[model samples]
Target: MITRILLAVDDSPAAMASARHAIELAACLGARLHVVTVVPDHSLSNLVTRMGSHPGVHERRDQAAEAILDHVVRLARASEVEADAHLLEGDAARRILAEARSMHADLIVVGRSEGLDRSTTAHILEFAGQPVLVVPPEVR
Candidate 1:
């Protein structure tokens, strides 16, 4: 009964792999895909502004997130699955969970990058109310 799937993705290789898996799963289940990408808040940029960083850091992040989401949506639709894209700002896990709930998703899918920042995935696993499917880096 997985009619709605929420996929949280980034631009990493592992994330792309997860996107592919999500597309396949959605097609197989005849489910719609909700693709989401989150941009961190401006706190870091504000702090770094004193050191000479530009003020458009958050804007750049937003653009990047939008680009990633667009790519994901294109892939999903190319697979013949209904797909929508979302760009969210704030804590990655919090925004993702909120989006999933708002969209009435039946399952959550996330990609684990090879790097050490597992905080987002861990947070989702610890707090998500629905079942979560984690696509690991090795799956690539």
Candidate 2:
């Protein structure tokens, strides 16, 4: 009954692992995949610009987010699963949850990076009504 899957990814090794898992799960379940990447809020970017500290920071982040989405989407399509990409701006956890609800996803998938704080994943688990699958970093 899990026909729609929402995958939140970043440019991290763990996220790549999660992308692979998501692709496999989608293919097995015949589910449509929705891939999403979030950038920092526009207001924060503006503040940084105003401070004259990091010009083009937002642009770089956007480009990186696009690349991440493109890579994941391509992988999903190669597995013959229908996939859509979303580039969102704002809080990562909130945006992901909203997208899940917007797409009516049956499940959510995310990656837990090694040594990184788990606040984002924790928030998602605390609020997401649907089941969530957390993929750990691939051990080499």
Q: After superposing candidate 1, which stretches have Cα over 4 Å from the reference?
A: 53-55, 138-140
The residue pairs that clash in candidate 1, if any, are: none
Writing each residue's lDDT as its tens digit, candidate 2 over 1-140 gives: 99999999998888899999999999999999999998878887788889987899789879888999999999999999999999998888999999999889999999996554389999999999899999999999
TM, every model: 0.90, 0.92
Candidate 2 backbone clash number: 0
List per-prediction Cα lDDT, in the order shown: 0.88, 0.92
Name the best candidate (by lDDT).
2
| Deviating ranges (above 4 Å) for candidate 2 | 114-117
TM-score of model 1 vs. true structure: 0.90
Cα displacement (Å) at residue 100, model 1: 1.4
Worst 10 residues of 2 by lDDT: 112-121
